[model samples]
Target: MPYKPIESYGVIGDMHSVALVGMDGSIDWCCLPHFDSPSIFAAILDDEKGGHFQIVATHEASFKQMYLPDTNVLLTRFLGAEGVGEVCDFMPIHRDKHGNRNGIHQIVRIVRAVRGSIHFRLSCRPAMDFARREHEVVLLPEGAVFDSEGQDVILLSPVPLKEDGKGGVTAEFVVEAGSCVTFALRHADDWTARNDLLSMAIDGEEARSRTVQFWRDWLSKSKYEGRWREMVNRSALVLKLLTFEPTGAIVAAPTTSLPEEIGGVRNWDYRYVWIRDAAFTLYAFLRLGFTEEATQFMEWLRARVSEHDGPSGPLQLMYGIDGRHELPEIDLSHLDGYRGSHPVRVGNLARTQLQLDIYGELIDAVYIYDRHAKRISYDFWCDLRRMVYWVIDNWEREDEGVWEVRNGRRQFVYSKVQCWVALDRALRIADSRSFPIDRPRVIAARDKIYETIMALGYDKERQTFVQVFGENALDASNLIMPLMRFIAADDPRMLGTLDETLKQLVSDSLVYRYELEKGSGLGDGLTGKEGTFSICTFWLVEALARAGRHRQARFIFEKMLTYANHLGLYSEQIGHSGEALGNFPQAFTHLGLVSAAFYLNRVVGKE
Candidate 1:
């Protein structure tokens, strides 16, 4: 079988859920209600038996897909020798007065004939519970229905759909110029309720038009009328698509287990929100005039920080949509993994680890919130102050680093710098509001941490920062030193670190998190190679721009943007072959794109 590279997928979503549409016009991964939910269509893992929703031209054709100008509406065109046809895919937003988000998600694929004629093939094979249960199939005049184990997939198609066996349905029909074909699948607990196809069609179309307007209106408010506007806007749209509108929870990525390495065991589930990326996301959202998202995230952060009682232990690394804590890791041994990367796993096991840097992330987010949102309750300030005190007491302790390495714990330089950041931001907040903190102690901790990291993490021989004390390997996490203002952007040490990282960690101008050979050190106890870290690359671009290497920064930035699929979407890592790996349409990656684009746009001229 022919395998399209993983980067061939395009993403479509309403705030509540998302689907990955491939170049072959198949939705191989989709989770209903939320990004973390069980998949309704998961053929991306098991190509043959796992379910998928596909709409393709019956005739042999070459395919191309792009989003409508400045909108999330995807237009996929199939061009064959005899004719041409297009499939316009979008998930219409349910909105209300004042633009408050509503909870309904609708995927509309409007098939239009652009030339003489084209035959269309429509099939929806939905495998629930990972294709384990047998489904009761029913055929209707309007379409086919499959009821399996309390989950129902009702297909509304204009053409007659026949059961192709094994809980699948297929339809082949012809359309001429000016003709249209529409299909929709609605998920409900009950399969007996009659579906109104005419209303669904009308509602779907209306939703599409409204969604386009919503996106266009959102982009219109962007202050980013600079160089690379198209790329920046596309990245912004993808970020918006990944955001869960109702709760203001932004997922790390839409689809999970895309794998970081091919046939290598570096796969991870990235459907949950990470504190590691929260502060940066706040900055990106605020930069784009997206206050609602920032506000929602800040609220979520407050809840997370407040829930864990005292600060002696590690902060929660990530959480479920409503902030549930228990993420029991599991491996699905039944299905062969994506592209023969075996042992498909779900529920990240890293949630329970002690990553010290999250304290810095939490503090930074709160500081920004204080600046943007009004002064919150004094109780909130007190809670923040206590958290800072906890960091000061515990920063010296060894814990899992930012990468959440699975081997063993070491005093990671990045973790130390962020601990300093926690104290620094807390000091700023306390001083700004005149809240009393042990001024000397906070300053002492800050300076001591800074000096300690510089003394230990820096390698005089290499003239660049190392991953840990007494280690020679370079880490992309050090790229944030200049971006975070921990060091002067042009400091000789910073320059050397950047150069060293470029030479070691970067691949074709993209960045990886760190050398896998070093071992992550947290000990979930697995070993394998993964994709180049997406956020690390953006950090490199930002550090480069800050260092006054605008030309190199701009080139790398533009080149990195090309890694995005046609819809301007990115995964967690770029594989060795440039295929998107390790989760589809990662939020952290999209946020990095937005942030780097803003900086690059400011420095470079309109291109």
Candidate 2:
């Protein structure tokens, strides 16, 4: 089989984990049990050695794929000279009446013929632990089981099958109109537990209907009745899927090591939650009236802060879905990386980096939630106050900025601005709620940050704010100044900064996070170039809309929407040729989409 393009895939999840389903009817990337679990099928990363499960047409067929309306249920249709067939793929949502999710992790696929007789082939190849562990296949009366040391993958099918002689299973069959076959890939700890989950026969039709209803009901809670409904809803659905429902921690993306530059060494694992990303995610959710999600995330954030014993402060940059602190980075040398992007990495090492901007993001999210969702508990407020003091004490120090640049830290202007944001929001919260605190100290610190930034961070000669202090290079992140209310959007300084950024960091409306020109020393400690950042492009859209450039913002916003994949999904970046680079269905990109769409609609609607 040939390799599929990164964007030629759709994703489905049970809110605990996700699987990447290709247009050619194959599951190329799926982490078992949880979002951070080791891959069981990873052909997307290593097509030759990584295992996969495929239900493909026997003969050449043209394909069309889409998600069922308002739901995550995916349908891929195949049309050939012989017949027409469709594959319906979804993960069943087993929720109780109380609106809590049950622990059912499975991917169900139903193959059915819609026209004349059609022939199909089914193949199941399980590579446990990223193909590092050996497994034994045990044939069962109902299906087959691939059992490793601690994990068991059960493949239950209602068709006859034969061993492929390579420790896998394969089946070939033909179906006429109105005929259908069902397959379920269930993951469990052992064979006993696997059998228990399979004991109850799942009515495929009933499960599909219920899953669709579950998504529709959840989406109905959205209060966004604005323009671009389809695109906005699709972005919302992707965000929902990326969220780890158990802990309310949203992973940045499901798959890891998808290169930002093809064959470049820039790939890093994104299957963990970052404080900045999660906070922005909460802000987006709140904008759409999804207060329940916002409140849940606030609870999660409070727990992370209260349980902190580390000297690094209240939180790390990122954490595992279950709030595990230690995420050691490792390389999978055995399996070749995606497109041979060498040294496939797992577990991000950036988690331990001191990213001071996280404090600002965290505090800002709490303030937004308090006003838009609900009141913060007194205990939570006390914890936030301590976090504020930490910021006040350490605001002058330099750390990794929002981009998580691997190069040695400098006095990033964005970081200092966020520290100002932290103190500013804290003061507002205190005054509005009359919370007891050191108001005088907070006010003085906030003013000090503003003064320092204006004095050192701004470059008078360039008439713009630079990427860092004492430099002339521009960055798209500085565009957040007006959005954060650090400066007025139409202020002369902000307008100059915006124009300089568009000139230096933008190419045809697509924005780069920063310039990597030689001798600029701002390549982020990586080799090779990268695609235009989708999030930064959307940031530009938001900045333009907020600056009263309504016509220009609408033009760029509409053009950017055309870059999304056929299913209205976005990866982290877009190559020069308009191909999606980096991890697929990135949460940050989608959050940007949601936010830009919301603000653009409001601004354009008023006109």
Error of 1 at 494 (Å): 1.1
Badly placed stretches (over 4 Å) of model 2 are 98-100, 605-607
Error of 1 at 317 (Å): 0.2
For residues 1-607, write the lDDT of model 2, one tens digit per residue. Answer: 6678888899998888999999989999999899999888999889978899999888789998999999999998999998899999999998788977767689999899998888999999988888899998888778888889998898888887788987789999898899888889989887579879667466788888899998999898888888888999998899999888887998899999999988898998999998999999999999988888888888888899887647567778898988889999999999788888877999998987888888888888889999988998888889889989988999988787788889878888999999999999998888888998898899899999999999998889889888887777787888888878899999989889888888888888999998777236775877789999999999899888888988888998999988988899999999989999999889999999999999899889554
Q: Write the per-residue lDDT of candidate 1 for residues 380-427, one digit (tens) a residue.
A: 777777778888888888877887777777888999999998999888
Q: Quote each prediction's TM-score.
A: 0.94, 0.98
Q: lDDT of all the models against the reference?
A: 0.79, 0.88
Give the candidate number with the greatest lDDT. 2
Candidate 2 global CA lDDT score = 0.88
Model 2 TM-score is: 0.98
